[model samples]
Target: MITGYVIARKPMYDFSDVIIGRNSLLRIEDKYYHGIDRLNWIDVESRFKQSAIPENLLNVYTDLEASEQDLTGIKVLKKYDEAVVLMSLDEEMTLKNEILVIASNKLNQIKGHGIATVQTITWLGYDIVLLGGWSLIRHAIFENRQMSLLKVIALNSFGLLDNEEQADDFLKQYNKLADLDSVDPLLDNSSYGVDCIRVGVL
Candidate 1:
C-alpha cells in the first residue's frame, strides 16, 4: 500500500558567461531538499506509523536535512548539470477497507505538478512511473523484457536471496539481459539504479 509522488524542478540562475556561480547551485539544492524533507515528515506522521510515529525515522530525516544544508555551503564549479528533487509517501493504512481522508487531501496538493505516480499492481508488487515532465523521458525501471521481474525484486530489496547462491538463482531467471562487464557476476544482469534506493528505513 506504499504510494506517493515526486517533483523535480530546474533552478533558474544567472552567472558569468564563462563560469556558473556556486551560490546559485547551493540555493537550488537547499530549496529542493527542504521540499523533500517537508513532504517526508508529513507523510510519515500522517500515515506510515500514524498510531505512533517512530522516533528513529524522524531522527534520520532530520539528519538528512542537516546534511543537505552542509552540501549547500560547498562551492560548485559546474554550470550545466541536472539537479533533481524527489518526494514520496508510503502507508500501510491504505490497505485497510476504510479510505484515509487525510492522505487523500495531501495527495491533492500535488495534482498537476508533473510528479511521478506510484501505485500497486498486485498484492505484493508495485509500479512507479514518471510523468508529465522531462523526467518522464527516462525509464526508472529496467528496460529488458525478462527483467520486468527485477522490478519486484528491487522494490523488495532482493528479499528472495539469503545467500549468494539464492541471489544467483534469482539472477538466472534474467540472465539474457544482465550486465556482464562487472567484476561481480551477480551484478552483471541487475538494473537497479541509484534513484530506487530507499533513504530512510522505518
Candidate 2:
C-alpha cells in the first residue's frame, strides 16, 4: 500500500459525510442531518489562506488543504482539533505513485522558517512531477488518476525548531537532497516526506 502523511492547515472533516448513507441522495440527507455543509475546494482553500497566521505561509498552507479534495472519495481517519498533528491514508489505497503531506497553519507561518526558506528547492526538477501543493491532489482525484504522491507536514510541529541552530540541523538531516536540481518547486511533494522527494525524476 502506498503510505504518506498530510499536515493540514485545518482539521479534517469527519468521514461520516462520505459513508453514512446508501445512496447519493440519502447521503445528502445524512449531511443535512449531521450539519455537514458541502465544502467546495475553492472555499476550503480560501479559508486556509486567510486563516494562516503569517501572510507568507499562504503558499504551502493552501497547497496542503487543496490536496485533500483531489481524491474521488476520501476518508478522514483523523482530524485537527483546535489544531492537531495527524496523518491520513487512502482507505481504498488507489494512489499508486503519489506522495502527500498535510500541515497545520501554526506550522506554516513561522518567520525565517527553513521550510519556507527552502521553498525554492521544491522547484528543482526531478523524475517525479511536483504539482504545486494541494491543488495537484484535487486535480488527480477529480481526474481519476491512478498514481499520485502527496506530502503534508504540519508547520506547527516545526515550531519546535524555532531556534536557528536547531532549524539548520533539521534541514541538514531532512532537507539535503542529492538531486536538488530535479524537483519542480510548483509540483506537490507531500507524498514522499518533503525532504526525501527530490527535485529530479522520481
Candidate 3:
C-alpha cells in the first residue's frame, strides 16, 4: 500500500479528468505513472477491505463519534460504532452523490464542531461508468480530504473501445500488449485503460 501522512492541506484543483488521473497515481508508490492496471486494483481492494472500518482511529479522537440520523433515499450497507457505510438506493442507476456528502456532514456535526474527519469510497457496478463523467471516484479523492484513496474497477478493453463492435479488436490489441509486458503503452498515457485504478492518502 502507498503510505503517507497529511502534513498540510493543499489547494483543491478544479474538477477535471486529468486531476482524477493524477490522484489515481498517488495511491501507488510511484509518482511518474499516472495510470493503473489489474494488479493495482487487487491491491486497492485489499486495502479497502482491510481498513474499511478503522478500529483505532476513533480512539485517537475521542470527542468525535457517529450519531443516529435519518437518511432517506439511501441504504446503510455497513453500520459500525465509528462509521456508517451507505449505498445509493435510487433507481436511476447512479450513486446519489449528495447522500454521501450529507452523511459526512452529519458525522462532522456530531462532534458539535469541525473536528470529525470524514472519508468516502464509491464502487461502480458497471465499468463503463468510469467514462460517464459522473463517477464519484474523483470526488472521493480530491474533495473529501487532503489525503485520500480512490479505487475504480474497469473491464478489459472497456476504456479503449468506442462501441461494442470494437471489443474484439481492442481486446486483441490489449492482449498483444499484455503479452509483450508493455500494457502501459496501450493506455495512451492515461489511467482510463487500466482494469482498475487506485488513489489513496494514508
Candidate RMSDs in order: 18.2, 17.4, 17.2
User: Which lDDT values do the candidates have, in the order given?
Assistant: 0.24, 0.25, 0.25
Question: Positional deviation of 155 in candidate 3, in angstroms?
Answer: 14
TM, every model: 0.17, 0.19, 0.21
* lDDT, candidate 3, 102-198, per-residue tens: 1222222322333322344332122111221222222222222212121122222222112234334434544454456543223343223322222
Please count the clashing residue pairs in each candidate, in the order shown.
3, 64, 4
lDDT of 1 by residue, 92-143 (tens): 3222111110111212223212222243222211122111111100121211
- Colliding residue pairs in candidate 3: 148-201, 149-199, 149-200, 150-199
**Model 3 TM-score relative to the real fold:** 0.21
In model 1, which regions exceed 4 Å deviation?
1-143, 147-165, 179-200
How do these models rank on lDDT, best leading?
3, 2, 1
Off by over 4 Å in 2: 1-4, 8-13, 21-46, 49-53, 62-202
The local lDDT score (0 to 100) that residue 83 gets in candidate 1 is 10
Model 1: lDDT equals 0.24
lDDT of 2 at 23: 31
- Report the alpha-carbon TM-score of model 1 versus the true structure: 0.17
Order of candidates by TM-score, top first? 3, 2, 1
